[model samples]
Target: MGYLEDQAAVADGLLSLYEATFDPRWLDEIRSLVGEMLTAFWDDGSGAFFDTAKDQEQLVVRPQDVTDNAIPSGTSLAVDVLLRAGMLLGEPSWTERAQRTLERLAPTAAKAPLAFGHLLTALDFHLGPVVELAVIGDPGDSQTDRLLEVVRERFLPNRVLAAGAGPGAIPLLTDRQALGGKATAYLCEHFVCQTPTQDPGELARQLDAFRAKALAS
Candidate 1:
């Protein structure tokens, strides 16, 4: 009944939902579920998640799986979700926990990446070029729609998108505002932002340039 995989799966879904909708409510739910997952499934001594919660009825041995099977292992998926959500939601604590999880499993994953495919995928995201895009304007406006379309269509791996009218609500949009009262897109990496752009074509060029730079590095 207290399965770590089930909880992690739900958390992963919630994370995807948040990305798609940019709804703060989904982020709140993710935070709550992640907190509960840590409290219930985390092994303090090993710093990895157990297959079952501590309070569950004990078998001969509690399983702690790190290898990826047909699907990503629960621990791997949990780490993936945690890292992404942490970055998007500005939760240092969640990111820290995810880092610890990766550190704990790094040795094994390094030696046998094939056995930990999902974990390696997660690690790639951690090490890869991650872009955070913020779009600001009236959500219902045509300009805002065009900007959002450019963002959603672009093929950037390990990307996070946040769109809204103003800055007061979403943390990612804290200081972001429209340029000249027109819908604008801001592309950032490692917390450094580029000049905000209103034209979709300009945004696309900037994104391509950013990816090129990332690849070069």
Candidate 2:
């Protein structure tokens, strides 16, 4: 294995793959990766993740930085994926660990906004009102594509998108089904879901209302 960021990037990429293909295997892979990430990088005493894994060669100090450069810092990316994975898998501990890390870094991040760009992104997700969107349909279906398009049309950073069907699927997709045998989209926040809609237009409207409701709060 490489460093914490490498593993973080892989988990994030698997989440993206799961969203695009709705493949359960990718979800499984992500679960495994997250487990490894926690085992190797998490600092129990500090509640902050280190850039190097536990098994890496001994060094005077374990490097842990939260500033964003060419890519997100390892700490920032770790928090980002943990929050998304927690929502996707219905595992609150993952989210809790991420929250602890953010709590430690929040003061530093607040002081240097430009350097902690991705860390702030992760913080925004943790604060509240992050969107949890789950669409149930075949990846190949054109109607499914239409609904997915509406979701991807705009930039919604605080959102987790999962599209798949059947039992043993990602938690976001489990027990969800198409409305009236048509591809359906479910927009949820804090575990409460609005009416499921299959029409792209209705989906768009519901998204707007949901977003507005979140922003209003």
Candidate 3:
């Protein structure tokens, strides 16, 4: 019985892999998985996702459970990952779907906070300001590592990190240049960027200011 209950969690794992490795392949896989998830579980009329695939054995009632217990609900994980990967990839449709799902669950989540802990966290990412950090540098460069370290050491939750030599195929990395022929960092909020910097200290200051502003809101 190949039930499609954990696809959202699987997509989340791929997102984590992308963050850790900075390999676009993981993101690509996420995109592909998202398509499958939508096709199999998404119900436009209900604005919810079922745990079982559409092609699976028909039951008297399709199971659609969204509760955060020992493991986060598939719906919550789906929304979180969709928001994260969707923003990074510049895909508005994915975020829109995730938002609609949250819209349906908002009142329920409000009344049952303990049961919807993970879903609330996902909502935070949706409602909070998200920082987009694009680090452009050739691989194995110490300058690049330093700039990344400044960002990695922080406990920034609503931030997305994209690192590579150039824009490559990532929309977040596009148009971000390496100033002065050195490793550079571009910090943006909701895709509107700040001045690019090659120094790690300046990057840290920028991230700190951005974090401060995010908190202020």
Candidate 4:
């Protein structure tokens, strides 16, 4: 149990860093590791994963439930890893694997959404467009710090966070060069970005509005 959780922790850490760095290598590494784990842990005929490894002689039943509980399930993590790899790397196989995982869990999700939060999160990622927020500045700077905080607090789904300084305004990317002395926020949903904003309050409101519009549609 500890070993599996540790592997998941490594995957999660890699994912968090990949969001900021946008490095393709991280995506590849995650996919490879996740794929290996899935291959070893999954029950090929049942379309489920055993909570315990196959080598273990002590397990009585193979657990396939995708419950969120206090921690994510092995199957849920596989789905998440596949979904992110596909989205970030534009790999069709990864997307297909994620879809398969979701399809296997659909009945479980329909029975109880809360218990399947992680599964639903993966589903949400696939169903709705993912937004990306890029903020570039010192984490300690007041304005930049506030902007980062507001962005993080927003409950928007399927979003990626990145950091760096950049040129003029662009789509799926922010032009933060204007905030010469402070931090900036670049919000991009479905590959279209709003103009860079320096005011944290304004950014929060814009995010609220955007989320409202998104949920309504």
Candidate 5:
């Protein structure tokens, strides 16, 4: 009730994002898992999602509201997944669910958009384009590690982070590998990709320049 709705909204945003990227595997997993997560805490009569799923074996009374200081709650993460799955998979059912969920959370965002930075970022994504980045390498390697670290510290909510080796790891990066000789970074915006960069400093500079331009627009 309290902030649970806000969390749902942000989650909707992120979900929409993941879907947009065609991560069917991720969607499949979330779709299978979220319902259980919800039932753990949800009170069927409340017409509101809870902070914790109703079925949580760990809690007596699962928290009923969302909470995130600079962002939305874990509830938001769930909602975002729902929203994004609809968009990415081109599923009307998913889209309808996301829209309904967002309608429920709209008032909160309207009343206090700043506090919900994650939700705001999601809203911004729909208005324009989002950039997706895949960083592949030893998550612990120094240079590849530094590159990923720097990217996250920046305000690039439009980007998604994945560390691994797979087809998903390709296309996104200009280079086929990351700095450690196996690591790689792929950047995409508006569904179009730019060459990936292996240089951590260059990636930072590139993102910095892009954000600066985005602000200007």
Candidate 6:
């Protein structure tokens, strides 16, 4: 059976893999999968993804599930994957589509928050502070490891992490270089970045402060 849920779950997992490993291959795979999902399952009139692909066996009615249950609804997972992946991969169209999906479900979600927990999570991410942390240095280096540890250990909501020896191919790492040939971390809010720092303590303090300010406001 060609179910939208299967494809959306795969895309969500791939997004996590990309975040954990920073491998562009995972991102590419997610992009392809999302493209296919949109082409095969999206309802243009409703801006929601159907449970079954349009090309699948015909049914009296094609159902679209928008509520979160034991597992997140396919559409909710799709929105989460698209939003995070778009931010990581520098793709605005994917994020826009995700936004549209949310708008389509807003009234229902607002009426029953408990029934739309997963969708609400995605909405929180969409409305939350977006932090992009880029570490520049050899991945195996101690300094780089320290910076990455700080990044991973921090409780950062709506955060994306990317590390490499140099700028590399990742959009977030573009033009990001280590200072004085030492590992450096660049923390950015929205699109504006703070000064690069090699000290893990400074990075922690900066990130904590940023999160505190966001929570306060």
Model 5: CA > 4 A from native: 1-32, 35-77, 81-96, 103-122, 125-128, 168-181
* lDDT (tens digit, per residue) of candidate 6 on 59-145: 898888788999999889889988987887788988988899999888988889999999998998998787888898877789998
Global CA lDDT of candidate 3, please?
A: 0.86
Tens digits of per-residue lDDT for model 3, 74-133: 888888988998888878888999999999999999998999999998899999888889
Report residue 19 deviation for candidate 3 (angstroms). 1.1
lDDT of 1 at 61: 92
Clashing pairs in 1: none
- Every model's TM-score: 0.92, 0.94, 0.95, 0.66, 0.55, 0.94
Score each candidate by Cα lDDT: 0.83, 0.86, 0.86, 0.68, 0.55, 0.85
**Residue lDDT tens for model 4, 1-217:** 3334445557777888765554546766777777666655666666556666666566566545558888887677777766765555446676776787788889869988889888788898888767667676654467766787787776766776655444212233343453666677777765567888888888888788878876887
Residue 3 of model 6: what lDDT? Answer: 84
List per-candidate RMSD values in Å. 1.7, 1.5, 1.5, 5.2, 7.6, 1.5
What's the TM for model 1? 0.92
Q: Compose the digit string of candidate 1's lDDT tens values, residues 1-217.
A: 4788899999999977866666668877988898899899987677678889878998999898778989888899888888887888788877777788898889988888889998887887888689888988876789988988887787776787777786644577888888888999999987789989999999988988988887897
Q: Write the per-residue lDDT of candidate 5 for residues 1-217, one digit (tens) a residue.
A: 2234544454454454443343436555555454444454344454445665333354666664443465456555554554444344334554454445456766887888765656555556544445566666655567667767777788765554555444442234333455446666666564455677787777887778778777777
Q: Where in model 3 is the C-alpha error above 4 Å? A: 1-5
For model 6, state the Cα shift of residue 129 in Å.
1.2
Candidate 4 displacement at residue 76 in angstroms: 1.2
Off by over 4 Å in 6: none
Ranking of all candidate structures by their lDDT, best first: 2, 3, 6, 1, 4, 5
